[model samples]
Target: MDSEVAREQALDAAEKLFYGRGVQAVGMDAVRTASGLSLKRLYQLFPAKEELVVAYLERRDLRWRGRIAEHVERHDDPQERIPAVFDWLEEWFGEADFRGCAWINSYGELGATSERVVAQVRAHKRAFRDYLAGLVTDAGLADVLAGQLFLLAEGAMVTAGITGSAEPAAEAREAARSLSRAN
Candidate 1:
């Protein structure tokens, strides 16, 4: 196969394996098997397992943010857009394969040992926070409200992941509504 095709296939496999199983638990051999690529081709595409992990994370980050943005964009009201984010989260959390935030899960597994993984996690989080800040600003809310909303969303993700329920997203949405009103 061509380089691009091979690389995408490898990444597809990596995402499934790493996200379904913890990054640390899934090995390169598993990725190669899942991708249907030869060991040598897999290595050529991803020089190391860490490189593959980073690529998986980068791709997931774009898709995850895009999904939330798409859902938020459905709201005509700026204030409503903020809570729409939680609505998207609730939908995602309801997925049968839902395993919580990919970045957070990867960070828990690899952040302490891998600087590259740590960087990816931080970048995803910063981008998310900045997105929330923009939403708050668009709604004529104080900058601090963005931070508060960010914390609420993050906490909800953690709670939902741990409890394996979508209740946290609804709870966070209500809290966000209350905070927006106060602001």
Candidate 2:
């Protein structure tokens, strides 16, 4: 298979197995079997299983942002967009395959063993936080308001993780709307 096509297939399988199964439980062989690629092909695309996880995470970040932007484009108001953002997340949280945020799951799975992966996860998180922070600020919320909304959003992710329910995203959206009244 072509490199891009091969990479995509690998990522698709990784996402399914990683979320449906745990990251640590799924190994390179599992991914190789899932992707229908030869062992050599899998190794060529991903030198290590950790490297594959990082690639999987990078792909998740792209798709996650795309989900947010898809919802946001349907509305002009940033305040409206904030809840819409959570709406998308709510859908994801409800998915049976969604154990939690893949990136976050990977971070916890390989914390001390791999500093490189951990650093990448932190950067992804920082970028996410900053992106939402900017949106809050743009919606005319002060730094304090922005911070509060950010915390609430992060809390929603954790709540979903802990409870395996979509309620947290909806609650977070409602709370974000209330915070919007501040602007």
Q: Which is the leading candidate under TM-score?
A: 1
In candidate 1, position 161 carries an lDDT of 87
TM for every model, in the order presented, reads 0.98, 0.91
lDDT of 2 by residue, 52-169 (tens): 8888888788888777778766878766766777887898889876687766777788887988779778877787778777777667776676667668877888789889899999
Error of 2 at 75 (Å): 1.1
Residue 167 C-alpha lDDT in model 1: 95
Global lDDT scores for all candidate models:
0.94, 0.81
TM-score of 1: 0.98
Candidate 2: Cα lDDT at 79:
62
Best by lDDT: 1
